[model samples]
Target: MKNMVKRYGFNVEASLPKVPNHPVESKEWLYGRTIINAVRVVMKAQDVQISIFGAENIPATGGALLAINHTGYYDFILGGIPAFVRGKRLVRFMAKKEIFDTPVVGSLMRAMKHVSVNRAAGASSMEDARKHIEAGELVGIFPEATVSRSFEIKELKTGAVRIAESANAPLIPLIIWGGQRIITKDIDRDLGRSHIPVFISVGEPVDTSGDPEVATQRLFEAMRTLLDETRHSYESQYGPFDGGEPWRPVSLGGGAPTLERAKLLEIAEKERRQAKRDAKKAAQAGGRRNPVTALIARLKKLIKK
Candidate 1:
């Protein structure tokens, strides 16, 4: 692991040519058909089965804001494939800038006319998303900003609602289950599992005409419900949540981290911290060597005696 980490240390900041964004046009439908069909072929080869529901809830035409729960790296494909295949439309996702900076991915995203967001650049991407929305593009966003380590829906960012309101587009809540177990940020949890069944549930368009904060909360609630339903659906077909839990780590067949292991880790961490503090205190006491003051004190003591 250490060698692999070191080998790939410099790739993130490696120099890559800038990729320009392509404007959405009539040809996009053709691109969507080709790309989505290709993805389905590949997934079929891997024996990956996908079940998508509420797809008709997506607006057949015009722009819409897709608020998705990010699970793992394959989330884009998982979310995009179902939407594209069902709706016969491509969703322009607001992806992280790093993806747009990578060599091949950057080119593909630009070609797909997806918006690139540099989190540190503040709200600059909002305007870009709004522009795409105004152009009648189905603009999708993973509102969690990043995948949650626990496989649970994390707090959503307000960007999706803001974009929806600004573009006067309806906000559609989407939930994806079982993507996290395939690949995850937690190295110990990732088993590189394939042939897993993934489920996607799309909710009706959420009204975003109200306050952005309120609308965002409403979206989160809807997404949470959809996520629960999707998880239940996944488990119903697969089996128990213990050994085959979709929300758990891949190591435990995707079950959540064990409580006993967590408790043991906590105790060990506390002991290590306490030992470091005690060692620091001992060193401070041992290093108290003020020779001049000690000599003067001893002479004064002798005179008094």
Candidate 2:
């Protein structure tokens, strides 16, 4: 806690005078600025460069629903960045009950005015989100609900469309590519390569009235199209996703280590260790020098001549 204060100033929980229930109130707090700036600082320090397109599509005011594809744990920050930078709107995202119940994390979530959803009873939180939207706040939802290992926009949930229709809010599609490369669910922890490029492409708001299934489909296609366009733009400027697709799952193109692959790697490492032990024991018993090292020394002596 003290280290966090020294690094990022007083904890957001301590510095705020009053907790914000709405986005408008939250944005006015110094805590909001602190968290946003902290994310920016971390992104910069990790060399995570962000590319944003179609930011003009975000409405400057009024209630809006952002439907962003979920790719990784860090994706919410990426999903919210375009809105934060362009529209200056603080997006309220609904988190699962488990996350919202965490001690430190829950405090931060409360400070940020994020809604907490009960996994078993999601409707209550959905109602809360609808109310926030009706109050003219920008609400963001990861319709996928979980990170997509395939890196492709997975099938989306109807919660976002339902919220938009209920609140009469415009549904804006947000697509983010390459965030999983920075960190993925496959590994316990992977501080990925520095200067990794993260692409965010926002699309025009879609109609939310009428059938929500159709609306959800439209949003999915829009996000898919934006993802493809962002990929093209990224590759055109930088390069391909190397020999393996940086964002895709290994089965697709992501090349992230999988459970089966990890197991094989572990076995191989154990075999190598056993072989080393066997070789050392044999050397000790026979009093034999390391042939490879002896050969290198002999070569060095001959070169001196």
For residue 72, model 2's alpha carbon misses the true position, in angstroms, by 1.0
Per-residue C-alpha lDDT of model 1 across residues 1-305, encoded as one tens digit per residue: 01111110111111222222223332465356566667666666666656666666666567778898887877887776434533356788888898899998798889888899988984899999999888888788989886666566667788888888989888899887877766755434443336667777778888887788888889888998887777776667777655755456444466555445434544676699899999999999877858997799889999999
TM-score of each: 0.70, 0.72
Using lDDT, give the best candidate's number.
2
Model 2 Cα displacement at 59 (Å)?
Answer: 1.3
Q: RMSD to native for every prediction? A: 13.5, 16.1
lDDT of each: 0.70, 0.72
lDDT of 2 by residue, 1-305 (tens): 11111112211112222222334533656445788877777876787767666665776667788898877888778877766654356888887888878999989887787888886888898899999888877788888876665566677888888998888888999888777767766544446447777777788988877788998888888888887776667667676556565455564355655535544654676699899999999988777667997799899999999
For model 1, state the Cα shift of residue 124 in Å. Answer: 2.1
